[model samples]
Structure formats: C-alpha cells, structure tokens
Target: MAVAIAVTRERREGETRCAVTPETVKKLIALGATVSVEAGTGLGSSIPDDDYAAAGATVRPDLATVLAGADVLLKVRGPTAAEISALKPGAVVAAMLDAYREKAGVEALKAAGATAFAMEFVPRITRAQVMDVLSSQANLAGYRAVIEAAYAYGKGFPMMMTAAGTVAPAKVFVMGVGVAGLQAIATARRLGAVVTATDVRPATKEQVESLGAKFLAVEDEEFRNAQTAGGYAKPMSAEYQAKQAVLTGEHIRKQDIVITTALIPGRAAPVLVSAEQAASMKPGSVIVDLAVEAGGNVEGSKANEVVTTAGGVQIVGWTNLPGRIAADASALYARNLVAFLGLMIKDGALAVDLDEEILKAAVVTHGGAVVHEGVKG
Candidate 1:
C-alpha cells in the first residue's frame, strides 16, 4: 500500500500560511503517496477544499482521524504536545517545530514514539537548497517588511519633483544582511528609496552596494573577519560594538524608514535600535521590526503591534511578515516541504535513512529519541 501523507490546519492564532497547496498535492500523489488534507486547511491561503479534491487529495473534516492515519504529517507550525499525542507511535511528523523554544513539544514527540523533522533545522547547504524553508519564507517576509514600512511612513518613498514643491525621497536603513535583510534592501531600493544597510559580516557589503544601497558599518579589524564558515555572524568585542553603535546611531537619525531583521536561534534577539534612537528619528519616520517575535530588534517594539512614540515615530512589529502574503508564502512553503519529503519517499512508500546528512540535521526526534544534537538535551 502507498504511504499516507496528511496536512493539517494551523491552530496558532494569527498563523495564516498552510503546509500544503493544490499544486503540491499533485506532486505528492505523483510520488505514489496518498495525500489527505483537513477540510479547511488551505482556506487561509485562499485554497478551498474543492481545489485539494481536484488535485487528488482527500479532504477530511476530522483532524484527529487525519492525523492518526497519517504515515507522514505536515504542518506550518510546530506540533503542540496535544497534536503529537493524537498521532500513531510510528507516524512521521514534519513542521517548523520551533525546537529551541518548544522543549516540551520535543519531549512529547519522543514520548509519543513519533519520528519528527523540524524544517527550521534544514541545513543551509547546496544539496538542501530545495528543502530550505527558511530561505523561501524569509524572502517573502523581507519584501513585505519594506511594503509595511512604506505603508506606515507618511511621505513618499521616491522623490517627486512637482510644480508646487519637490518631495524628498525616503531614506531607508536596514540592519542585518541575512536572506531577509538582502531582500528587504532590494525591495526598498525598487521603491526608489535611498537605502543603507549594516551587518557584522563583511561579505554582505558588496551585496548591499550591488542592490544600489550604501553599506553602513564600522569597518574595524574584527569586522573584517566577522563571519564563520557556516555563514553565521560571530560576536564582536564590546569596544567594537560600542564604536559601531555610535557610528550607526548618528546615521539613523536621518533615516525616514528603518527595517531590522536580526535573529539568532535559542537566544534573545539582539537589540539593534535603542529607544533614544527611535525618539531622535523625525516625526513620520517608521521602523519595522522583523525579529519582534524573537524579542524585538527595536526598543519599545511590541509583537504584532504598531506602536507610535510620543514624537510620532511608528514601530511596526508584525510577527508573521510572510503570512501577510498568504498565497505566495503557502505555495513556496509547500514546495519546500514536498522537496524535503521527496528524499524519504521511495518505491511508493516511506523510507527514512537517519544517516543521511540532511535528514540527520533536520530530523529532531526519531525512533523514540531526541535525535537532533541541538534540540536533544
């Protein structure tokens, strides 16, 4: 018999993106997998039950039945403890699985004897590019961040030389130059904003300049070698951080819009913007904090809230930036999940090899044990 793959509806408040799409349903079926999705699973992404049925997936209403019979279960967010408890002992569950923060859920998966894969742990390697959920989702989040900033700013992004009076172009400053940060810079530039970006990694300076934006950073000796081989930023010395802060602080006051996208797993997000800096910004200026859910990069920024300072500056801290573009995010995320599942599906059945490098990195719980090194205590 063919393996059963199920996609569940997200229960988290404010989570609109789904783990499956009609297009991916066909792809899953082509691999000889029997695909089943919850009745209202794709509604948030504007995909109805009829569409999933048309694509050959069984749309069931009972989530418990769908989960219990699933050989492979897919989800947008991590499965809660209650979710894992509903599945069979040997069921394979795949999702973002926020292992760093959801320690109890990881333990629950182990206790339930379910093999679980955390998409967030998908390795950033050449072979795993198709399975890289972070890149696909972050790309959309970055684009939306610039759009959100533009919406909040009172003035135009591009300069307009009118017969009455010339409108000056908005100045956009983006902190952090990761996947999200790069796309944010590109989107801001596309809107004709004079964009400037900063990052601890020296390699991104050229990338920022290529996007028609200036790169702002204190290029000290430590700055030159700030990135590790794994493409993560290394911590800088206290003196270097202070010097860089002073330099960036002066530049920030002139910015009309600022978007910060710095996040590190298992740690509080680094504070990039101070309250004083926000206060110093001119009235009508906007700040979008992409790392707000991980503890805000901007001071006084609240998750999923637009806070207006006494000076009239606005801080946007939306937790689900990619979900704002629901359709596109769902499509890309579904494709990523399909690609990951493709590796384990063989001869019209489930076949998992824990020795595989990508699987080794992404699989958090397998054979009733916490397998991933980072997540396992």
Candidate 2:
C-alpha cells in the first residue's frame, strides 16, 4: 500500500508559508507516495489549487477530509490541539515543532498516539544537509531583514552623487554571522551599503570579510574557539560578554542600520544592543532584531512590532522574517521536507528506520511517548 501523505494549511497567525508546493508534490508522487493537500494551503505562497492538481495531488477543501486516513501529516508549524485531535492513531506528523517551547503540543501528540518529527531538530550532519530547514529558512530571513531595513530607512543604501550633492551610503551593522547574518551582509553590500558584522565564532570572520563586509568582535582566546563542531555558536563567558558589550555599545552609535540575529537553541536570545546603545544611535537609525521571538537581541525590540526609541531608532522585531517572502520560502522549505520524506518513504510505505541518525535525532514523539532526548524529561 502506498503511504498517504497530506499537507495542511498553516494555522499559526502570520504564517504564510506552506509545507508543500507543486514542485514537491510532483517529487513526493515520484517517491511512490500518495500526496494530498488541503485547499488554499498554497494560497499564501501564491500557489493555486490548480497547480497542485496539475502536479498530481488531490486538493481537498476541508481539514477533516485532508486528515482523513492520512498516514503522514506535513505542516509548516506544529499542530494545534484541535488539529492533533483530528489525526488517526499511530499517524506520523512532521514540521518545525519548536518542541522546546511547545511542551503542551508535544504532550498532545503523544496522547493522540502519533509519531512526531521536528524539522528543526534534524541533525546537522553532512548527509542531512539537504534536510536542514533552519539554514534554508534563515538564509531567506537574512535577506528579508536587509530589505525591511532599507524600506524603513530614510536614506538610500548606496551613495548617490546627484547634481545637487553626494549622499553617503548607509552604514549597516549585523550581529550574529549565522546563515541569516551572512545573507544580510551580502544583501546589504549589493545595495551599496558599508557593512560590518560581529559573531562569537571566529570562523565567521573570514565568511563576513569574504562578502566585502568588515568583521567586528573582541578578539580574545575564548572568541577564537566560540563555535561548536555542529557549526552552532557557543555561549561566551560572562567576562567575555561584558567586554564585547562595551565594544558593541561604542560601535553601534555610528551605525545607520543595525541587524541582530544572535540566538541560542532552547535559550533566550543574547542581548547584543543595550538601551543606552539604542539611545546613542542617531535619530532615524533602524535596528532589525531577528531574534525577537527568542526575547530580542535589541533591548527595545518587541516581537511583531516596530518601535521607535526615545533616541528615534526604529526597532523592527517582526517575527518570521521568511514568511514575509512567502513564495520563495515555501519553495525552499517544501523541497527540504521532500528530501527528508525520502528517508522514511520506501516502496510506497512508511519504512521508518530508527537507526538512521537523522531520524533518531529528529523524531520527537513515537509510539505514544516522547522519544527525542532533548524533549524527554
């Protein structure tokens, strides 16, 4: 029997991206899986129902119909309680579960006798690179952050020499040189800005400079070894953080635009911009905090809101930056999910191999229990 894979519309507020697309639907069908998608699931991403039908997917109108007899459920975000209640017993669910924060959702899935896999928990191994949802989404987020900043900024990014006078290029400072930070640097440079960036990982300095952006960091022994083998940034000691803060504080006042992207897994985002630093910035300067959902890297940032500090610095704390560019984000995210699907679907059936490192690391709830080590108590 062929595995029944159903993709649902995202129910979370402000989530415009979908888990499946026409391109992925075709691929999933090629893998000998029967693919179904809820009607309007791709509307947000500008993918019409006709496109999915054309790609050999059944587009059901109601959630109940979509969930009916589904062997595997695909979603962009974790399922809500009501949605989970609609699932069949022993069904498999996959998405960016945010399992660390959504404990209640994890419990619900366990109680519903469903197997859940978190895309965000996919291991950062060479073989699992194609399934890396975080990198794919964050890459788009970085580019979108710069686009948002440029829209909010009063001056042009590139220097303009008009007949009247010469307008200096905007200065852009990006904190955290992860996937998003790297893309932000490249985008800002393309727009003719003078870009500089900081990250705890010493390996990022070369990446930043390679994009024609200046690297800023407190160069110390600890800074030289601040990255994990998994390519994640390690938390710095308090002493190092204090020194870095002081340097960043002084440097921020001169920047016309600042973007903060630092985030630690299962922890609050590190504060990179103090209130005083924000106050010191010139009026009309903009700061986009990509870590706002994790308690904001900029002091004045608030998730989903644009706030202007007393010093007149605009703090953009919009969550889900990639959602702002829904079409491309959906395309990349769907491809990532399809690649991961290939690991479990074989001979038109769910052949879950628990021994696979990627599957072992990503599976959060299986056999009516929490399975992932990090999610388990």
Candidate 1, residues 1-377: lDDT per residue as tens digits? 99999888898899999999999999999998999888899889999999999999998887887776789989999876667778988899899988988888888998899899999988899989999999999999999999999998888999889899999889999999999999999998889899999999999999999999999999988999999887878877888889988998999999999999988776788888999999999999999999999999999999999999999999999999999999999999999999999889998989998888998888988888998888766
Q: Cα RMSDs of all predictions?
A: 1.0, 0.8
**Model 2, residue pairs in steric clash:** none
- Candidate 1 displacement at residue 45 in angstroms: 0.6
Of candidate 1, the 10-residue stretch with the lowest lDDT total is 78-87
User: 1-377, model 2: which lDDT tens digit per residue?
Assistant: 88899888899999999999899998999999988899999999999999999999999998999999999999999998877999999999999999998999999999999989999999888888899999999999999999999999998999999999999999999999999999999999999999999999999999999999999999999999999998899999999999999998899999999999999998889999999899999999999999999899998789999999887889999999999999999999999999999999988889988888899889999899998888887
Name the best candidate (by lDDT).
2
> lDDT of candidate 2 vs native?
0.94
Which pairs in model 1 have colliding backbones? Answer: none
**lDDT of model 1, residue 11:** 87
Candidate 2: where are CA atoms >4 Å away? none
Going through the candidates in order, what is the number of backbone clashes in each? 0, 0
